[model samples]
Target: MEFKLNLTQEQKLIMTQQMQLSVKLLQMSNFEIQTYIEKELQENPVLDAEYKKNDNDKAQDEIDYKKLIKHLEFDNYGHSSYHRDDEEVSPFNFISAKKSLKEFLKEQIIDLNETDYIKSMCEYIVENINQRGYLGTSIEDIAEELTISQELSQRCLEIVQSLEPTGIGARDIKECLKIQLIEKDLKDENIFKIVDEYLELLAENKYNVIAKKLKITVQKAQEYGDIIKTLEPKPSRGFYTGEETKYIVPEAYIKKIDGEYHIIMNDGTIPKLNINGLYKKIINNEDDKQTVKFVKEKLNSAVFLIKSINQRENTIYNILEKILEIQKDYFEFGDEYLKPMTLKEIADNLEIHESTVSRAIREKYIHTDKGTIKIKDLFTTGISRVDSIEDVSTKIIKKEIQEVINNEDKKKPLSDQKICQLLKEKNIDISRRTIAKYREEMGIKSSSKRKRF
Candidate 1:
């Protein structure tokens, strides 16, 4: 009786290779994703990182590529765009140098389907950007040096401006911050004006002066100042300087466009992946079992990798879409408008498991006008409002407490209890302990230490 085999059906969860790939991809930071992609490109012949022309059209490809890129190559990742016919390119080899600001700009320039003249102009403009990430010379000087019209030189500078490191080629700090704000679709707004003209006043903590000039409240001025402070004055801050570089590549961009928010994946960091057409042709024409089987396996792996990468990106996009829909006011206005949100809330709304949402945002970042913030920062606990049934985000509470502390009389800074009472009067009821906790979390010293006198 014990020797009999029992046939029973039971449900069990299994992680298929593709499922495992997706899970791994969902949690990888942007640099990790790039490194993973580079590895795949090296190991999988079927996965093409970019066009490597067939031998038949190699001559034509050389001529076309020569117009824009003059032997473009990266010194690390054992990767380079230019290859000799006899050279063996290895993906497994690695060094540590990342692409510099100029190299990064030139890559995008070559990819642009623009005329060679325009490409050259863009390259010249990129070259002119100083280490501090500002255009070291005036547009007039560039035009004279290039023997081109000032309008054309300005246009070329604008092209560089449109590139990543969002404010590249800016002439001054005002333009640098303004360009970033514009990338966020915040042009000519209160924050933009504050950055454009009142930067010095803001630096001096002249909120009332700015408020009087802008016809807004002092609190609003302070809010704008906070947001402006988050912007980068030096667009080249994280760029490869002479030392070893550890640059942060943003996962996505949150842009408010035409009265609606849009989620744009940062495709610039991740190379476009394509299943090699040559692999398909070989599999169809080859008769050897070993050759066909090897091609088929690689092709399947390439397809799965592409699918997993796409699934990861879409999951991130969906999460951000939901976040934007819920927190549109925050993006348009300020952090105080950020609503109560959590991973569970996003999972429920997106109709997915909670961990999926969590992993999708793990170590991920979004480039916002406020700066590159962790996507995980978007999900926060709620603190109930005193006068309404609705809730406020802990982020909003923290910002409010910061503003309160910042504006308190330095000679007699407000204590935790007094801060709590002030917040209560404003309908944000919280205990002194919560206020103290938030203050500490924000790195604000105790009120006694905060006393200026």
Candidate 2:
């Protein structure tokens, strides 16, 4: 065997430490960036943070204290006031902590007049109910684990199901809906039959099949489907999850001034950074070579950090400006008017790579008059219509599909094919399969399931 060595020249992209930091900072959310800044502040002695004064603080500072004091002294100093009997404290004001679904269920179990043994069993069952208000363990499993009979465990489950939310202990979605229906006194022999036997058909929007089986008119079947739609599938849906709610802090604000959208970067939360004067003096003194070298290195790091933060802000601002230009209709008219966009489009416009655009918008949010929205939500793939030269956004198509379904006749609910045809009339040339895909994505049932009577 022989080994040969040859000099090879090739160009490869290399990211420096500062470059990596800039990329990392660009992708971080406002909360994450704040935490990172706090950590960096602790570690970097040369780097200092300057916080901006809040608007409320400035307003309070501008208040006339002498006038306020005079008004308070004259109005209330010698006056006798009676408390209004009708003005009671809100119950919500007394609540210091939110109860999880499990805690709420356990509280109900405690109030039950059942024996301690049954209550313990009920408590155990409640503990196993997942965040979705469905039992995580089977009755047989619970019975074997707790050394209780299946009958007793089943009764405990029934008791738990009877608790508020109407379907806490249901094994599955069908049982959940059935329990809700029963509670509302809306359950009949046919409703129970449809829930048990024809749930799949109901989901497919096959009202005709259901009507034929139940020997009822299409309108009557539609009534049953409508009633089912009113039931809450997710009974535990508004209860607090164990995890804390994440509130999005917007990095930029888009405001319409004189019928034109303007992009403003929010630097309010970002700390103003500068190298400590003492550290700069230590570097310039040159009295201690070692000390000078250390201070210089730290100073360089601090400068790079400041530059990276600025670069992050600039990149985000440019990206949002381009988005504003492209999605002007969305900004003016709302989500329904959102046009299809892509990372590549923004990257092309800004003369940056697709990955750069993605990083710049990742985990970042923008606030507009419409409300706070994720930066990524502004970009969607397009579906072109046959009649129109311009493309339609998938989001817009989904919204249109929902509208078509919402306005549809219950007895003659539009199937995916019919939906595709209807969309075609509006210049949306999508396939039946694509229509079905979009329909399902919006959680709409099939023609079979949609049929009523």
Candidate 3:
């Protein structure tokens, strides 16, 4: 046995707390960054909040609460006949209103002429309805929980189902579609049968199978399917709350000028940070060691934070520029022209790790003529075609598949195999399974489900 001291020298990358914070800040959305800044402002004495000025020469933080109250009164009550005609109306009297699905249903329930017991039951059912406007609890469960008869529970369920949204209170998607179809009173018997028994087949686009079962022409089956397509699948889709709102603030902008594209970083919204001048003065003149040490530490943290923000902005800018270069055709044309790209490719080109590129683009968006698009959306897996050396983007392939399905003959909707053939003819070598996967992803039914009778 031998024990000897062996010394080895090796270089390894270790991320400091400041560096980790920089990566986290780079990945945060603009809204999230603003929130983080506010939190930092509250905790760090060396950081100060900067308020932007409007054309009215008022600091944004100095809002007029009295004016806001006046506007609200003008909008809600000023137009009444009892109000004085001489009162001046402000042009900014309008206020946005939002109503949740439950509130809307409760309002409708209030209008019903049923007994208080029945109304309460219906209200309970409404409360149990999910955000998708489907019943979250089973009639049996509701009946047991409320100590009511099953028959009463069923009646209450029916009452809730008859609400404004056609598909409201359905137990499942099949029930939802059936409710909408029954409400429309469209004279299509096979539609009901398909919804009840052959929904799986209908989803697969098996029009031929439906035709065989219903003893009708493929065209008629297609007509029935088309009618079903008009029904709303999500009864509560438009009634999403504030949490569901997708707030996208782009960090960069790409503009086309004189036949060349230019990349511009969006730093206007980001706060420009600097160490508090007063704190620096305190540190320089303070005689107490403890006070000086405290100020020095805060100043260093503030400085590091500012540096991290600048680095994040630069790194993101460079990443966007490279992406724009690679996906120039996509920007010039449309989604159909989007080329295949990966985080690794960008990382290799930028001489950074793939994770760095990923973190830089995560939850970040860029503005273009098309619209605001997520940076991550630009990168997709490539599908290699037959005759070309270059690989095609899966996004482009999905778009092409959707187009093929949209233009397809309803009586004879193309099968996944046929889709593969069509794409192969255009030099895309996608397999049938991949084609089916993409088709399903796009919410397209199979040929059998698509058949008409």
Whole-model lDDT values for every prediction: 0.83, 0.85, 0.83
Error of 1 at 49 (Å): 2.6
Error of 1 at 340 (Å): 1.5
TM-score of each: 0.54, 0.77, 0.78
lDDT of 3 by residue, 318-407 (tens): 898899889999999998889989999999999999999998988888899999888899999999989789999999899889889889
Candidate 1 wrong stretches, greater than 4 Å: 1-14, 51-243, 281-287, 369-371, 409-412, 451-453
Candidate 3: lDDT over CA atoms?
0.83
User: Candidate 1, residues 1-453: lDDT per residue as tens digits?
Assistant: 577888999999999977888899889987898899999888988888863344545543444445224434445533444455654333332234577889988999999888999999999988888998899999999999999999999889988899988988999889898888888786547887788688888876777788999999877888788778788888888888456646777888998788777888886668779887887778877678788999999988988888888888889889989998898887888777888888999999999999999899888889987788888887889988897999989988898898898898987889999999999988997999999899989888787656442
The model with the greater lDDT, 1 or 3, is 1
Q: Judge candidate 1 at residue 227 and give its lDDT.
A: 77
Better of 1 and 3 by TM-score: 3
> Which numbered prediction scores highest in TM-score against the true structure?
3
Among these predictions, the greatest lDDT belongs to 2
| lDDT-superior candidate, 2 or 3 | 2
Off by over 4 Å in 3: 1-13, 54-93, 115-117, 140-153, 186-193, 207-226, 241-243, 257-260, 285-287, 380-399, 403-441, 445-453
Model 3 scores a TM of 0.78
Instruction: Name the lDDT of candidate 2.
Output: 0.85
